[model samples]
Target: MPPHIRIYDVTQNISSMLPVYPGDPGFSREVLKSLEWGDPYTLSALHLSAHAGTHIDAPSHFIRGGRSVHEIPIERLIMMVDLIDSGTVVSPENLSGLNPLAEGVIFRTGSLTGYLSEGAARACVDRRLKLIGTDALSVDSSEEDAVHRLLLSNDMLILEGLYLEGVPAGVHTLLCMPLKIEGAEASPVRAILAPAEWHQWIL
Candidate 1:
């Protein structure tokens, strides 16, 4: 086996304590069987929104007749990613000088106010990026619909609610796999980042 490279988990823990979007179902677990009750095994049922925690948004999330979670190509989920910290607002100016061919771009927005302007979203599409990700819950809280439409219409995947607190800004190999829920618009993912050199070994 090849030597293991360091990996950073960018996913948030799905638990009752984790926050959810307004009106979205919070994470919860109901025990159906328990060892405390002398049951043969412990089994629990989880209840949460598909967008809970670290998740990928299919085009169908905003566009009618768009591709669903199961329809997304796996190649789009794993790729080279540019991790950029644009603070609160990711404007077009923030994206200046970036590699135009990066398969994915992950914004490490440290605050809830962090979001992409419509112009920035267009820039991403113009650069031919296949995916966009952010640590924030939503890319544009004010003009969310428009922003989402701009990206999704261009066949760009959106990853939201990433826990990128300590991740460095650089090119990394992203390995994010969402559940293949048929006809679902979104699905939670176990997102991770590793050195770009690890890509070949991982594949």
Candidate 2:
């Protein structure tokens, strides 16, 4: 309901060609009927992993008996976010200047570096962040998934596969709401970013 000077679409386009996490199902679309084929109207079905593209991860993803996607309130998804450029590695030292007022933090790593160190995750925990987003597919570079468990067990949400290539680094209004699929651990989202000043217009 408020005007914005600029808006950044941070969601990745889901298509057959879109790169997915290793062992995860690639995105696909089937056209059961189409106007191009003389059908009355266009109809199609999509198939993709819940974590495909830009998606948010619920605590159920790693923590046993944790909250699921639909269980999270919409208010938790929309909030003030501080985007940080943390290079290839996200460490505690680099995250020391996090914005105190921001509820969410998105790390813009120039490359697809799965380098969310344990110390870095702990730093976020110390700050009591509600959400932690990253351009990488997974927060942990190691196969142990320590980072995932550490954050999720603390009731913190994880947002992955963000498109932050040209997005500026600073405070902004995050508009990312996951699909409300009951019992789903993760869901694709159309994440967007607007100027932080737009927060005043949000109720």
| Predictions: Cα RMSD each | 1.9, 2.0
Across 59-174, the per-residue lDDT of candidate 1 in tens digits comes to 99999999999999887788888899888888887788675546889888797557888889998988889899999888877545788889999889999989987788888999
**Model 2 regions more than 4 Å off:** 1-4
Candidate 2 lDDT:
0.90
> Can you write out model 2's per-residue Cα lDDT over 1-203, one digit (the tens) per residue?
86537899999998898878778889999999999999999999999999999999999999999999999988888889999999778989877788878998999876665568899999999999999999988888845689999999999999999998788899999999888999999999999999886676884
lDDT values, one for every candidate: 0.87, 0.90
TM-score, candidate number 1 = 0.94
What TM-scores do the predictions have? Answer: 0.94, 0.95
lDDT value, residue 71 of candidate 1: 99
Q: Which model scores highest in lDDT?
A: 2
lDDT of 2 at 166: 83
